[model samples]
Target: QREFTQKKTFTSWINSILAKHTPPYVVSDLYTDIQQGHLLLDLLEVLSGQHLPREKGFNTFQCRSNIENALTFLKSRSLKLINIHVADIIEGKPSIVLGLIWTIIFHFHIEELARTLACTYNQPSLDCSSAVDSSPKASRSAKKSARIKERWKMSATKALLLWAKEQCSLHGSVNVTDFKSSWRSGLAFLAIIQTLRPGLVDLEKAKARSNKENLKEAFRIAELELNIPRLLEPEDVDIVNPDEKSIMTYVAQFLQYSKNLPESEEDLQEKVREAMGWLAAQEKKLAKLLVETENETYYQKCKEMMSFMETFNQEKTPFLPVLSSKRGEAELSEGQQQMREEWDKVVSQINEWKAKLDQMLPSPLDSIEAWLQEVERLQAEDLPDLQDPFKAMSVFREIIVIFKGLMDCFDSHLDTLQSFKNEDEKNMPLVLPEKLEEMKRRLFSNIRSTNPSTFLEYHYGLCSAIANEVKLKLNICDVKYGAKESVESLLENW
Candidate 1:
C-alpha cells in the first residue's frame, strides 16, 4: 500500500537523522544487545512521527515480550545510568514520555506496558490513544487506560514536588545566618516548580492538601527545612509618614509587591499595618511639638508688652504735658502763643504715633482685602480643579494651617491693643474707648467666626468631591471585576 511505502521512507529518514546525532557509544550498545533492539525501534518510530502505526500489526503478546526483555536488559546491565539519563531527560525535555506512551498503545492495543514503564520511574503515564472499536475488550481497555492516566497524573504531581525539594537542596542550604540568600534561592526554586507544575502550586490545592495531617506535617517540615523567615527584611518595610507624597509612593509600591505574595500571608499584612501605625505615631509627635513651639512664641511676645509700653510713654512725654495751669491777663498773649506751639507739637507727636503703629501692627486688614480680591479673580478665572485626592488634601491642610496662623496673629494683635488701651488710660489725658471697643469686636469676630466659616466651607467641599471620586472608583472596580467578592479581595490584597 501507499501508506506502507510512506512509513518505510519516513522511518529511513528518521534513522538517518538519529544516526547522525546519537553518540557512538549508545549506537554500539544498541547493536551489541539484540534484546534492546526494540527500544531503538520504538524511539525511531516516535521520532519518525509514527504516532499510530496501521501496518505490520503487533499484538499485545509480542509487545509485552519485547518490553520484558528490554526491562530485563536495562536492569542487569545499565540500571543506574538509565535512571540518571531518564530523569535528566524528563527534566530537560518535554513530551518524550508521552510519545513513548502513545507508541506503546498504538502497537499493543493495551495500556499495561506504558503503565509499567511509568511505574518503573514513579512517573505518570499520559494516555494519548483513542479506542479503535466498541467491543467488550475495547471497553475494558478504555476503562483501564483512564485509571492508569489518573494514576500517572498523580505520580507526576508527586514527582514534581520531589523535584522541587531536590532543587531547593541543590540551590542552597537555608539557615538563620544566611536567611535572605537562602530564602531567595528557595523562592527561585518554587518559581521553577511553578513553571513546571502550575496547577499543583495553587493555594486551593494547598488547602486541600492541608486536610490530611500527614501532608500538612510534611508541609510544615518543608517550611522548617527551608527556614522561611517569619519577619520581613528591613529594606522591605514600608512605613507611612507625614510626608504625604513620599507616603503615597511607598504605599503604592508596597501594594504592588504584596500582590506577588501568597494571599494567605496574613502575618505579613499585619506587620505592614503595624509599621504604618508606628509611623503615624511619629507624625503625631511632630505635630504636638509644632503646636508647643507656636504657643511658646505667642506667650513670649505677650511678655514683651511691658518694655513696649515703657518706650511708648518715654516718646510721648517729650511732646505732651500731664496738665496746664491757668494764665493771668498780663500773660494771656504769651499763653495763646504757647497754646499754638503746643498744638503743633501734639500734631507732630500724633503723626509719629501713626507711623509707629503702621510699622508695629502692619494691619492684616490690608492683606485680607488683597486676599479677597485674589479669590475673586481666581473664581472668575475658573481654574481647573485638582484631580488627585492626596494633592487636594495637601492644599486643604495648607489652607487650614495658614488660616490658623492668621487667627493666632489676630489674637496677638488684640492682646497688644488691649495693653495699649490700659497704658493710655493710666498715663494719657485722651482715650478713644468706643473706637478701640469696635476694632476689638471686629478683629475677634474675624478670628473666631469669619475665617472659620471660610475654612469649613472649603473643607466640606473638598471632602464631598473626594467622596464622589471614591464612589466612582468603586463603581469602576465593580464593573471591571464583575463581583463584590472579587472586588473586596482585590482591595484587601491591595
Candidate 2:
C-alpha cells in the first residue's frame, strides 16, 4: 500500500515537472516510463535546469548507458543511493524505481522546502526595534536573548507540521500530530482548502463522509481550483496507514502554490502591509549584523546574514512591488512606491553587505600571504639566548607551534574556498599561480625539511651548540683562575 501511494505521488510529481518542458511529456507508469532513462533525464533537466547528456538509441546498451548517466549525475549531487543500480531500474524493478524517484523528491523538493521554510520563521528582531515591555527585567531578558533568537533554525518537518496544524486548527477533530495517521482521515486536507478558500470545502459535509470520500473530494478540489497536481489517490491515503513521505510531498505543494492564489483587494492590501512590516524587521536584523568589527563573531554573523539574504532574494523578492512598470509607467500606489523604494534600498544594502563580507572573509591567496608574513617574522626574529636553555627551548617550541597552526589554518581556508567554487563558481576567489609560486619560494627559502619541523630543528640545534660553547668557556675560565690562585700562594710562601 505504501509503495502504491509512493508510485502515484512520485509519478505525478515527475509529470508536473515534465509538463513544464517545451513539449510536455506525461508518465502513465513511472517504472516503464523511466526504464529507457531519457524521460528520467528530461525530468531531471526540468527539476534542476541542467542539461544532462544521454544515449539516444533504443537498444539494451543505450538504455543502460542512459540510466547510468542519470545515476552518475545523482551521485555527483552527493545523494546517498543505497542498493540502487542501473540494472534494477532497467529491468523495471518497482522498488528500485520508486526508491530512485523518492530520493530525487527528497533532494530536489524536500531539502529545498526545508530551506525555503526557514525564511518564514518570525525570528525576534536583532535589536529592540519593535516595542518592548517597560519592565527592566523584561527588557534585560529580551536583550540578553536577542543574539540567540536571531539565529533562527528549524527543521523542515517541524516547520511543516506547525503549518499544517495552524491551517487545520479551526476544523473539527483534524489534529495533525505527524504526517502519517494525522492525515489518514483526510480531514486535514479539507481543512487546509477550507482555510485558503472559505467556501471551497464544506467541512461539515466532509466530516460526515467516509475517509475515502473525503480524501477524493479534497484532492479533486485542490487539483481543480488550486491547480495543484493530484499526487495521491483516495485509496492511497484512505488506507489504515498512509505513506508519511508521500503525504509530506503532496502537502508541500499547497504551500508552494499558495502564493499564486488570487487575492482580493483587502487581502492584497494586507499583504502589502505585512510585506512592509517584514522588510522593516529584516532591515533591523541587517543593521545589527552590520557591526564594525574584525572579530570572529562578526565574521560568523556576516556569513549568516549573507545566507539569510540569499533566502530573502529567492522567496521574498517576488512580493516587493516595483515603482515603475516595464512599459515606463508609474503603476504603483503611493504606499507601493514607497515600498518599492524601500525594497530597492534594502537590495542595495544587501549587495553592499555582501561585498563587504567577501572582502573581509580572507581569500585563499590572502590567507597564504598572511601566513607567509607570520613565518617571515619568525625567521627574522633573533633566536632565544642559550644562557637559559629551558626558556630558549620553550620559545622555539612556541614558534614551531605557530607555524604549524598557520599551516593548518591555511589548509582549512583553502578547503572553504574550494567548496565555494564547487557550490557557486562565481563566488570563488581568484587564485593566481605566479603569486602562489612566489610565496611558496619565499617560504621554502627561509627553512629546510620543507616543513615547520625544519625551523624547529634548526633553532634547536643552534641553541644546543651555543649552550655547549658557553659551558666549555665557563670550565676553561675556572681552570685558569685556579692556576693563577696557586701561583700567587707559592710567591707569598717564598
Candidate 3:
C-alpha cells in the first residue's frame, strides 16, 4: 500500500513538471480533455522520451555523424533536447520553426520509428493497425473509414487482373464457381496495395496518438457534420458462423457478373457503383444481425478512421510542393522555372497513364503549383505547436489517400465495366463449379440461412467487384509506364 501510494505521488510530481514546461501540441487534443497541464506534459515527456536515441544512429532515426555528439549529450540521464538546440543555429528562422523541424523526424516516417523501437526496446506485442478493410465502397469513402476487421472479409489477392487482361482471357468463358473467389480475391488485392501504401502506417500512428475523446468527439461531429444516422461505434460481441451454403450462393452470384467484361470506362464505373451499393447494403444487414447476436465490443473503439483521413487530406496540401516554390517568381532564376516544368513533366507522364484506363486525370501540373502555394501559405501562418509530430504524419496519409485513391486515375475503367455487367452477360463466359447441381442446392440453403435479402443490400455485392476491376486497371497502367522512357536520347536521335 505504501509503495503504491509513493508511486502515484511520484508520477503526479513528474506530470506537473512536464505540463509546466511543454507546449500543448505535444499533448494531443485527441486523447485529453481535462486540460490539466501537468498530466499532459508528463504524457508528452514519456512519449518523447521513448523517441530518445537507444544505441546507434541507424537504429532510431535518419541518423548522421554530425548529430552524434549532440545525441550523446541529449540522451544522457539529463534528458535534454540538444538535437533541437543544434538545429536552431539557423541564421533567420524563428525559434518555433526550429522546433517544428524536429517534429518532422517522427511524422514523415513514424512507421520506421515504431519498427525500430519494437526491435530495440522490445515494445508490446499488441498490433498498431487494427486490421485491413478491403470493402468495395471503401474505395471512395464511408463517413471517413471502414475498420480493418471489416476489410478482412475480403479474399486474398495474388495479382490484379484488369479489363485488358480479362479481354485476353475469360471475358466470355468464366462460370459462377470460378468467379466467386476471383472477384473477392481481386478486390482484396487492390485494397491491400492502397492500404499498405507508405502513408497508411503514419496515419494510424497519428490516430493512435490522438486523444480518444477528441477523436470520438470529432467522429461525433463528423457524423453530425456528415449526417450519419445512429452514430455510435460498435464493439465486438458474439461471432456469427457463416453458413457454407451461403458462401456458395455468394460465389454463384459473383459468376453472373464475370460473364461480361466492360470495354468503356463509363461501363466499368457503372459496375463499380453497383458494387458500392451492394456492399453497403450487405454490411448493413450483417451489422443488424450482429447487433442482435453479438456483444457491443466488436466496434467500440471504431472511430471513423476515414474522418482522420479526410482531415489529413486537407492539411498536407502545402508541404508537398514547398521545395520548388518559395523562391519568389521575380527572384526566380531560369533554374527554378526549369525545376517546376520538370515536375510538371513527371505529372503529365502519370496523367497519360491515367487516361488509358479511362480514369479521371489529376490536375497534374496545376495541383503541383497549388500544392506549392499551400506550403508557402502555411509557412507564413502562426503554427499551433513547436513539437507536435502527429500533424506531419496526418499530412502524409492524407496526401497518399488523395493521390492514390481520390485523384483521377484508372479506377474508372473498372467502375465503367461494373456498371453494365448484365448487358455484357451474353458475351461473358460463365465458369460453373464441378458439382453444379449439388452446389446450387447447397448454395440456396446457405442463402436462406444468410437471409438472401442481406445480399440484396450489397446492392448486388458489386463494389468489391469494382474494387477488383480498379486494381487490375492500375496494374496495366503501371506496366505500360515501366516499359520505357529516355527523353534526352530520343531528342538527340530525333
Candidate number achieving the greatest lDDT relative to the actual structure: 2
Instruction: Put down candidate 3 lDDT per residue, 359-432, tens digits, no spaces.
Output: 21122322322332232232222212212234433443444344334224333422432342222236532211
lDDT of every predicted structure (CA atoms): 0.33, 0.62, 0.28
Q: Please give each candidate's TM-score.
A: 0.21, 0.48, 0.19
Q: Give stretches of model 2 more than 4 Å off.
A: 122-154, 170-173, 262-267, 270-494
Residues 1-494 of candidate 1: C-alpha lDDT, one tens digit per residue = 32222223223323333554334222222212222235444553443444322223245445445544434433443232223233322232223332332233223311222333333233221110111111121112211311234234323322222222222221111111111122221242232233222322332233233223323332333235433211122122112111221111212222222223342335534433443343344345434544454534322322332233334323322211111111222433443334434433432333343333323332443343333323322222211134554565566666667655555565456566666533233574222343345345444432233423335545666887778888887776665676789877988975
Sort by lDDT, best first: 2, 1, 3
Query: Which candidate, 2 or 3, has the higher lDDT?
Result: 2
| Colliding pairs, model 2 | none
Which segments of candidate 1 are over 4 A away from where they belong?
Answer: 1-357, 360-393, 409-416, 419-426, 429-435, 479-487
Q: What's the distance in Å from true for residue 493, model 3?
A: 22
What C-alpha lDDT does candidate 1 achieve relative to the native structure? Answer: 0.33
Q: Model 3: what TM-score? A: 0.19
